[model samples]
Target: MTDITDAAKRLLLGKPMSSERLGHTLLPKRLALPIFASDALSSVAYAPDEILLTLALAGVAGTIWTPWVGLAVVLVLVVVVASYRQNVHAYPSGGGDYEVVTENLGKNAGLAVASALLVDYVLTVAVSISSASQYVASVFPALRGSEVIVAISVVVFLTFMNLRGVKESGKAFAIPVYMFMGAIGLMAMFGFFQYLTGSLGEAESAGFVLTTSEAYDQGLVGLGGALLFARAFASGCAALTGVEAISNGVPSFKRPKSRNAATTLLMLGTISASMLTVILLLAMETGVKYAENPAEQLRTVSGGAIPDDYVQHPVISQLAEVIFSGAPWLFMLVSAVTGLILMLAANTAFNGFPILGSILARDGYLPRQMHTRGDRLAFSNGIMTLATGAIVLIWVFDAQVTKLIQLYIVGVFISFTLSQLGMVRHWTGKLRKASDPRERSSMRRSRVINVIGFLLTGTVLIVVLITKFTHGAWITLLIMALLFLLMRSIRKHYDSVIEELALGDDLAAARALPSRVHAIVLVSRIHKPTMRAVSYARATRPSVLEAVTVGVDENEIATLQAEWQKMDVPVPLRVLNSPFREITRPVLSYVRSVRRQSPRDLVVVYVPEYVVGHWWEQLLHNQSAIRLKSRLLFTPGVVVSSVPWQLSSSQGHGVETTYFPQSGQPPAMEDRKR
Candidate 1:
């Protein structure tokens, strides 16, 4: 079983890369762009849909504001990109927002950013994968109801690909990411060309009359109307989700890491903003209509209910269908690549989450195991942790992009606001210390950019909180708070442990030895295992030695005594009465009594255990011994050790077999009969 599992793991993850090969995993700018920017790049696919969906709540009057809201989101994206470019140049350690905020705003603020980023990374996977599943369903209508399953399967696949190693997965995903870019770019070109030539056609849904619900029957008016647009802009900000990933993943880039990372960030921002602008423009020109509840919110021009079997495809799909009306294959290609990119978009989180987790772990904010690299030189624990989180979220939300998206962007925006604020502080500090005129001028300019970024992101953060609070954004904020507290608790525990274990100046106290060692061998029967336990205990050369057992069965005890007396074993056997037949309690009581009698003396309990070859054999033995050892471990001056006796079935299963002197077989097995 172990061999098969190892083989399967190797087949899936590929052979483990040595630590020396870590340098080879560094990503070039081309690959790093896809690895770190896929999420931001792919968001153009759904950000428009979200904007239109939100505006649709106000009916047709609301949908007309899509372009303005999209432009607003793009403005924030560009500023965030510029702000983070400065972040990379200043703090190139790949700690990203956490490091910058911790350094400038103090540790508490840093932890807040860390928790926010962690939550956002998780949402990135859930929302991106769920959106991808939607695209898949659009292509193959038969798979519509199974979006949850499809999304989870894609998550597992991405996890496996990432576990293989960053460089390997980056190479594999680069093609799909570029294909998505090409497909979108081509569609945008053709879409605008057709519009310029007066040959563009209306969307299939263009003929459908969108009606206002009671909530927005008065149209975009008063406070409610203002709040509605705020909400729409907040939703469209989801496009900026992956922009910070580049800052977080700076170390993954090749030499000139900061420069390459900054360049990639600019490229990502430009591409994302352009694509979003084009998509929204084309949607408006094509008269696309998208709603949170399509069937109930949309009706035929004749005022009749739409068919129950009608499917409302996403905005990109609708745009493709109309823009490529003469070419059916282009529409399919557009849909396929959009889905492919959305799925690969999760790769950004896969790459960013682990690195951030490792950084947090290194700072004692997470489990130490998260800091360790796996066979592939990746933070495997963190990768698996992210994957598990995403799968749970996908399952809980039923893989609906609309539902999952409600919980998205809240976290990324939180990080963005704080990180930009930190950058502003960082540049201010640099300017204060700089004497060079050129350096001071550059610092002031960078500071201004970050100041603008902070104002914009902070305002958006407030709008997101106020507008999306009841719409499931509150859940994200709650989770971020809990994670903040949890990380604090973890760091406190690690700090306490460190302080308690720190070396003191008292050498004598540190090197003090126990007065004496008392050894006890636990026996279940007068068999080879018991004999081996006795022999090993005797070899320890303790001041006192004895064999102990619980009196579970009188008749068996009598028979065991008879055999012991007949063999004249050197060690004496002491049995503790267990009227209730509780092995662990009686043994624990006896060991504690021994410790109480000699406070300064050391007590060692040797347990005889079976060495099993198969997994199932583990269940048949040593359960009571395990329980007893666990109890004894907490007792002061008490030590627990296991003495293993391998059975015939335990051979050739990887564990080394040791032949004890008291065993029937010779050390070399020369005298044993086959």
Candidate 2:
């Protein structure tokens, strides 16, 4: 029997969990909708702010075009959702876009999508936590400079929840997710009712006089104006960041995985689109406006100066204040819920990056340890890596959502474009093989959707690069390139190791025993361990055998020789002098000389080792034998074995127990009894 150590037992806590238990970690459609869709859905919290801030570059009149930008983003969103529905049905292995592009296209294209999604997952954690921090700061002004700490703390909390396992985290997030949806829905409903009653009032920031930046001073009538519109559209596309998570998570769904995932995607699209559209329309109807430099762009219409100390609250806060109409409790509830939901958005990446890492590990593209699930069946290593990366980003960017926002959305669009391109190829291949007319028609329709998705996402990608690359998107691209090279090197190393370990016909010839056997027993004192070593070696029936000890002190050597003679041991005892008291070097030189004497023979060195229960016991004894064994391992054609003798302290401790019989014979007591 193999004695499992405590460390080994702890490390394998969740090994070999059944696939059926995996379903318990598997998400139902209702919980899955929020778990996977939170990223895209929560974008409504900040996407409008991005759009308005970009349009504000051209002053208030430029902001008038915000509704049109929202409309364009919605059109693109619809096309992407329809196209990915085809992707789910066609390739639902949960490799998501990475596998699809790599399989249909080539490795380079697939790697490109993988790099993009990797960067996107990082930014998702950074941006969501930062935005949530801003919401918290609005309610509690004391947390102003501590935003980075707050954001990183939230990320760490989510990481631990995810490490507990997928189903556990999903259930934890269900209530807050639903509350977010309900709060946003109620706010939108009341705002719409106020508008219908002809009693809707302007946002808190509405009456501030607008000032245009030099880039947008021309006010919507020139080349600069068109470019500003493109920039705003690109920024608004931030809402699409989490769309690909569903395709990556298809395997985590209940039975009919793809269909359930596709349905969840549709629900995600409908709810996100409706909420975003309603928010933008209400912002327009309520005369809400935003600026990157709020203090500079905003002024009192009464010719009084707006306070320099005033912090411009987020668009959600401003809108909620007006909609709730002095109902302080309702206002507080909505703000709290929104902040909580945004923090939970990090859960999307928490679930996503680990699952993708496990797939890559299985394919030899990542460290194999990532494939090992933890006590709760979660990928703990991947989760820790994700948390560390997100924390570094949050700190480096100072947890400013507006600044970090510029680096967002570029990766997701790159993946969207490539994945849609892959789907186009998939449908084309199916069309060529289909003999039935109905199947051919369906393939053709799917191809059309994918083509449109490709075009739309490609355009958005280009616009984001043009607008945001200099701001911060280039940094994200560089990070992705580094990760790509890293994963490639890891895969190469694994492949090389596998090749080195492969067996061939030469192994049999190598396994044959040498023509002769010579054994040497290493002894320090004539104790039980030393006796055990001698007995085990003699049982091997070697052609030659001797007991050797290093002579470090003359008195000790004389005492040992007397003890050996008194016992009248059958084995001849030999002692080697060590002038410098260097045990390892003398033993190594002696073993080499013996091997040279019989070059064709095998040399087996047996060193008796003491097995101690406590680690500290090792420090007090066995120094010479340990050093000798270490040197012997490097010698060619030498097999070193340890004959363990458990100490009195080691007994009843269940330490270093073994079940294998001795090399050639049973125990002396057992042989006597027989």
Q: 45 in model 1: Cα distance from truth in Å?
A: 0.7
Best by TM-score: 1
Scored by CA lDDT, what does every candidate get?
0.90, 0.86
lDDT tens digits, residues 1-674, model 1?
76788899999999988889999999999999989999999999999999999899888899888888988888888888989889999989999999999999999999999999999999999999999999999999999899999999999999999999999999999999999999989999999999999999999899888888788898889899999999999889999999889999999999899999999999998999999999999999999989888789899999998888889999999999998989999999999999999999999999999999999999999999999999999999999999999999999999988888889888888888898888888888888899999999999999999999999999999999999889899899999999999999999999999989876898888789988988898988887777767767776677999999889999988998888889998888898999998888898888889989999888888888888877788898778887887788788888788777777777776546764433232322321221
Per-residue lDDT of candidate 2, residues 186-304 (tens digit): 99999999999987888888888778788776688787888889989999998887889999999889979999999999999999999899989999888887888877777788756
Q: How far out, in Å, is residue 292 in model 1?
A: 1.5
Where does model 1 exceed 4 Å of error? 215-218, 659-674
Supply candidate 1's per-residue lDDT for 642: 77
Inter-residue clash pairs, candidate 2: none
Best by lDDT: 1
Runs off by more than 4 Å, candidate 2:
1-20, 302-305, 505-507, 510-674
